[model samples]
Target: MAPPTSSVELATLGHRIRHQRLSAGMTLDELGARVGVAGSHLSLIENGKREPRLSLLQQIAEATGTDVTDLLSPEPPNRRAALEIELDAAQSSTVFRRLGLAPVRVTKGMTDETLETVLGLNRELQRREREAIATPEEARRANTELRLAMRRRNNYLPDIEALAEKQLRAAGHTTGALTHRTVSIMAEQLGFELIYVNDLPHSARSVTDIENGRIYLPPASIPGGHGLRSMALQAMAHRLLGHQPPTDYAEFLRQRLEINYYAACCLQPEHAAVAFLQQAKKERNLAVEDFRDAFGVTHEAAAMRMTNLLTEHLGIRLHFMRVSGSGAITRVYENDDLPLPADVTGSIEGQVACRRFLGRSAFEEQNRTTEHYQYTDTPAGTFWCSAQTGTTSDGEFSVTVGVPFDDARWFRGRETAKRVTSTCPDESCCRKPDSEALARWHGRAWPSARVHMQMFSPLPSGEFPGVDDSEVYAFLDRHAEQ
Candidate 1:
């Protein structure tokens, strides 16, 4: 056999050689004399400190009366050797090195139980380190990957559409806007009841009590316009979709997206949404606000629904953006080749959109009541975009829907005279400061930035991201009696 290249193989080979030599009733010196090497050299090979040549291995095998193949087997000679090998690997790991602790040397005095305990502690340390490492960067990477997958399919999910349609049909919803009563019926059909509570967990929008066939939601009226119906539907979606507890941050993100998709489908039944979009397109008057009013959903939700349906049903491609007041792109999707700004990781979220784009420019408009339209010429191509500003607890944000120049003819705002050009991905665009102003203000500005601490923290640790299981359980226990 060739010399062992990995430490693991070397350790295993050393253990096997030592085992065979001991079974042959020979000391290290006895074996070394028979194999033509010094006793100390043999000791180094036995301790896995150095690799033995193939010729020496063959000589040792013959002297020990064992086949070379037997000596080369991968299994450790005993459980003690296996534990020692595991400890050797753990001590050499990056996590171990980061601790700046000295490696624990294996000695004859160490017991198997002590080795097992140390290995258990190392495993727990590694797990905690991994949980801590699930930071915003990991979230961005996961979001970027999810966005790419959604983009490949034009941001449409046929399975979710079918599910929504099936549930709506069962709920006797053949109509205009989905009613709260209909949403309740859909949940009932799935063996779940919507329970309103004042003490819903702070971290959760809604929680499902699968054991009691109940979903706990905030105390909002059922038929009210506070998105209570959507919340209930999203909670029930977990059970309807047969979702398991998410194992990682990526899985958590995927489940959140899926549940949100299901909620949107329920809010605007796919068949009705497609027909509404089709008729709007036929009249060359497609507008997101009209769609939003027709479905009784928010402007942002309507824009997102358009992303889900336009390419799949109306045969028009588009992009969507939700930009914060500070110009950071909070949510984004594009299959229309719009040159949205992105970070080095291909993550668009948290990166600022160009001030010239409709997403940012709309925020500056005095007439925030109506959707603002703009034509932006980017490196990829020109896009006609419509943006509407909305305010939430987090402050102002703009929801934008845009399409390629050719597809603009099918929309209502194609004739808007607001046109601008952007050379984003270049510092001279909106990102760079004015040269003359910079020269005047150099070393004069000392403004403190508002740090978003949550962004720097690791993702909340639990089976469900951002949820506290103990609080949820206590809430459920309190409600279960009623």
Candidate 2:
């Protein structure tokens, strides 16, 4: 009421300017020189005793690497407005172009609320500490609870909105709105300060501003493309919900394994070992060494894949047998009811085992009767094959791929020895088969074989393969002469 208290307003402006100047490492005299004003006038302006002209303000802001609007912006109840202004300026600035992403805005109102809440919490904590009522353990527990609660709430609006923004940006979309209510709830759950949430706009296509952090769900009419939306949703869920234990880990592993195997199959088919299986499918012949060569995956990965294929895909109950003295079965992973050996050391590579037993008499018998079949080999020892023994399925011939061990080997030299040793009584050795040799074997095994093969063919001698550097240089030389 007394002259509208200009001093407080001037003081606030002065503080912001002073802070900006100091942050930019500029002295009062330097700032004054750049603004074309007297050092004393600049000092007075900072001390809240005088108001500088708009032009001078612009000059000062330019000198300090900021905008005139930012220098003259009225201090709002919250910092969100200030943040928005800053983001707007950044969007137009040269630096923003280099970043390649749109500048994100934080609002003054949201910042004020966040600061107030933090200050309140700090004060409460300090009071408790001063009263000798808050122990370190209590503080830790409180912090943990707070964090968990925040994480849970993060699924709601503002929090969800922020996450959606990130997701949109990642998906190569920009400029979208998220509903305020949705973002607020998500923000509340996630324990993030509201200032972070205020950056999102409300309503956008190709971008969403969700009200309650439900993820700015794409409208049903939009193409929501396969895999992309699901992936983004999963990412949003993870961010907001903090990954719910078993489900999260399982899903994460499943995705990781799928991607890993798919990439391996594409980039290095031999390493993935699928090439051998694919070859067998085409040629109707399978060899243990060929299996090993085509699927050059690690022993553990091979085992897991085999287990997955048999138990989940093929619906087969496989008894993993370990060959002991004289090819006698020492250990086995039979049905769940069958007890596992306490002292068994080695793991069977399931896929390899499946291929070995395929087309054998034992496998045929098992498929016909849906029962286990037993066969004896001097090198591999007595082996049992079963099909659909534990689970209901259409009775079909099943293969036993072996990760051959020492007892399975008929060879004597170390180089000729199989890569893996069997734990069966026979204790055969197994080795990766040579592809060329395996190809010849397949040709013989199936006389009228029509096989799909991927081979590395040698280049013909008449023409240079790919771009010939010498030819390219020669052409360039000829062009220059012309």
Candidate 3:
């Protein structure tokens, strides 16, 4: 009879059969005689190289004085067999295949000590591979450190702001909205020609060709009207800021944040943006949408820019958050002592916001056309918030800007009568279902979670964490020829 496709199960069965035969005090030849097979063929069966027929198995079991089930059990007969089985599995793994080495065949002559040594080496190899990968805990710790730094400075970076101001002045942009032409001129001032192409590397939003003094972007306009300009400016910011290739994920994150900040500063130049916001404050109409319109930027960008400038120039302590439809805090910045939901690692990015917080409640608002306002009483104090909903390819999100109740009078949404109380960080506030509902549904429901593969994956390999270097280089070569 033909053998079933070979696997660990067959190996385990062979070990059990060998063990039972020995326990019955029968030599291979003696067992084979009773089973009506050659000792060589019986040895092959005992070595997991052949499958025995059911009738043959019954005869072998009868000869060995054991049941057929005992001969087919999943467990190995002893410690030696278990080690051999584990070694076989390790050799069959992807990591073993990746080494481009021949599999080590286990033999009766191989000692247990040798098997243990080989297994130890394989385990160490796997440990090193895992160590090289960027773990979620490492990323969280890095983010926590960066967020603390941002909070210390009230989310403002004076040097980056000054650098942007110098470039904007050189581009001759001392006016209303920063035009695309001015962005182009800024690139020109840095000796970079703005070249749009459809074949830019998929991993990169824009690739700067330092050798050829060119910045390549997508031919199609980005979702937000100012995205092209922002990408171009951010690419130039890297060169202007004298950034080097990041050595680690933390450095990569810091570089990304700096470049984005530089772009925001350029988009909403300090002098003009501050003047518009001051006038809005004077009129007691400090609204994010009006700020967004005055600057021709996205709502999130306008709100984040407010975080940078409001505390430094306007004497206002505020908070900004971008929450997803599922209520996860995707982005946040604050110095208002507003108690935000965070994990033990002090990472807030993926934590769910309280259902009563404006960031989450805004999604339930009936009026989709206008901003939603609310006053939330929290452990820290009562705070007023203004949030507006926006949708992208990913899904809907809320961009919120808020302040303490004392400072709420300066904003347009303070008069809103809508209010709620949040006792979050205490899971009962939003995370935990009510007791009555839990009684009905506890242990009775199953959910298939939507897994985010990227969350489990290590940061992409290369000097730049997520950028494809080969693709980028090939793209540059293709465009450089033209």
lDDT of 3 by residue, 102-218 (tens): 988888899999999999888887666544555787678678889989999988999999999999999999888888888989999999999889888999988989999999999
Which one wins on lDDT?
1
In candidate 2, what are the lDDT values of residues 1-482, reduced to their tens digit?
Answer: 11113655555566667768887998898888887888888889876678767667778778888876666556732354333333334354433454576544334345656644544554454444334433333333333343234224321123333444443344343222222333334434543322222212232111112332333233333342322233233433544444432222223333333333332222122212343344443553433334333434322233324433333322333334433212223222333222222222122211133223322234334344332323323243433332211111323223333322322222112132122213422223233446787777865774676452412232211121223445444533543343
Candidate 3 segments exceeding 4 Å error: 1-131, 220-224
lDDT of 1 at 236: 83
Tens digits of per-residue lDDT, candidate 1, 18-48, equal 9999999999999999999999999999878
Prediction 1 TM-score vs. true: 0.74
RMSD (Å) of each candidate, 1 decimal: 8.6, 27.4, 18.9
User: lDDT score, residue 233, model 2?
Assistant: 38
**Sorted by lDDT, highest first, which candidate order results?**
1, 3, 2
Candidate 3 — worst ten consecutive residues by lDDT sum? Answer: 1-10
TM-score of 2: 0.19
Candidate 3 positional error at 210, Å: 0.6
Which ranges of candidate 2 are over 4 A from the true structure? 1-296, 314-316, 320-339, 342-482
How high is the CA lDDT of each candidate model? 0.88, 0.39, 0.87
Model 2's number of clashes is: 76
The best candidate by TM-score is 1
